[model samples]
Target: MSLLSDPTRLAGLVTREVRTGSRDGVPTRIAVARRSYQTDPADLWDALTNPERIPRWFLPISGRLEVGGRYQLEGHANGVIERCDAPKALAATWEWDGKVSWMEVGLTPVNDGTQLELTHEVPFEPEMWGRFGPGAVGVGWDLTLAGLGSYLSSGEAVDPKEGQHVHRTPEGRVFIRASVTGWGEAAIADGDEPATAQTAADAAYSFYTTEPDSRPES
Candidate 1:
């Protein structure tokens, strides 16, 4: 099934946050997002951890997903599972382009459904932070989470080609713009300078909205 909803509205469903922290004495930047799904915690947890169900919403994944196991997402990040608590939480190392980051997903039962919270932490890089801010990662997660919602609601796998094409559409552009703006506001609330954060958000929006075929190398 196709993603059938107002793009901006779908993007707005996520609550985004940005904060600063330290790990191993090094400063780290944290990006967090929360969204509620109209599904039970057990089902949501299965969708997240089950290899057979992951590609239906997110990317194609391979390798063991259990604790201490390494998993790779095709053409994306590869990671070692650090922790797994069934139907509650999962944590892993997110490695991409020689950079190491950490990601955790927490699931909680809610009145209407299940609430999923994702937190991504990475070593602070002044240059990269100034260029893209938290939106660099937040936007990607927003899209991924949106896909999850669509899949859970419609019981259909998201088409990879369609997912890429959507960003070039006007509605999809609106969605990316709003997601970037939200991340910018989150950074500002975390004590980042307003102007700098918004500037980085604009960069992120442009990068996301651009067609993949024409996108310049980072």
Candidate 2:
């Protein structure tokens, strides 16, 4: 189901933070997002880790898939599994070309489901940061969680073509715009210049709404 066509349970989905920090002397930003699923923690964990179940919601992921192993998402990013603790947490090194980022996800049992929190740590590149701010990536996770929500709520695969088309629609554009704006607010909260942050959000909005390869979360 499309976010625009369907507005079911939106409370669990949120962009928690966009924090600027340093790791190993390299400047970095961590985008934190949270969402809940009406499913068991173990079931949610399976949806994330089990390659066969992943394509039903997320992308088609394939590789060694074990802890300390390498994995690749079809037509998307590839990474090495840094850590994996069942029904609790999973961490990986997200790499594209030669650039390396990190993604860590943790699951907690909620009243009738599970809360999934994801932290994406990105190395600061002046050009990249200046161009898109954190929304360049944050919105992708928003899309990811939204897709996951649809999947967990129903037992069917979300059509990628339909999803791509939805992103180009007016409603989808507004969603992306809000996501970019949220990231800009997050950047300002992290001490960035207001003007610069707004500029970045605008750039991000344009890219997501117009750029051919902007749908990175797919």
Specify the highest-lDDT model's number: 1
- Candidate 1 residue-wise lDDT at 66: 84
* CA RMSD of all predictions: 1.2, 3.0
Enumerate residue pairs that collide in model 2. none
List model 1 lDDT by residue over 63-149, tens digit each: 987899999999999999999989899999999999999999999999999999999999999999999999989999999998999
Give lDDT tens digits, candidate 2, residues 41-139.
999999988888888767898889888899999888999999998989999999987889999999999997899999999999888898788887888
Candidate 1's error at 196, in angstroms? 0.6
TM-score of candidate 2 relative to the true fold = 0.91
Please report, as a residue range, the 10-residue window in candidate 1 with the lowest summed lDDT: 1-10
lDDT of 1 at 65: 71
Q: What is the lDDT of candidate 2?
A: 0.82
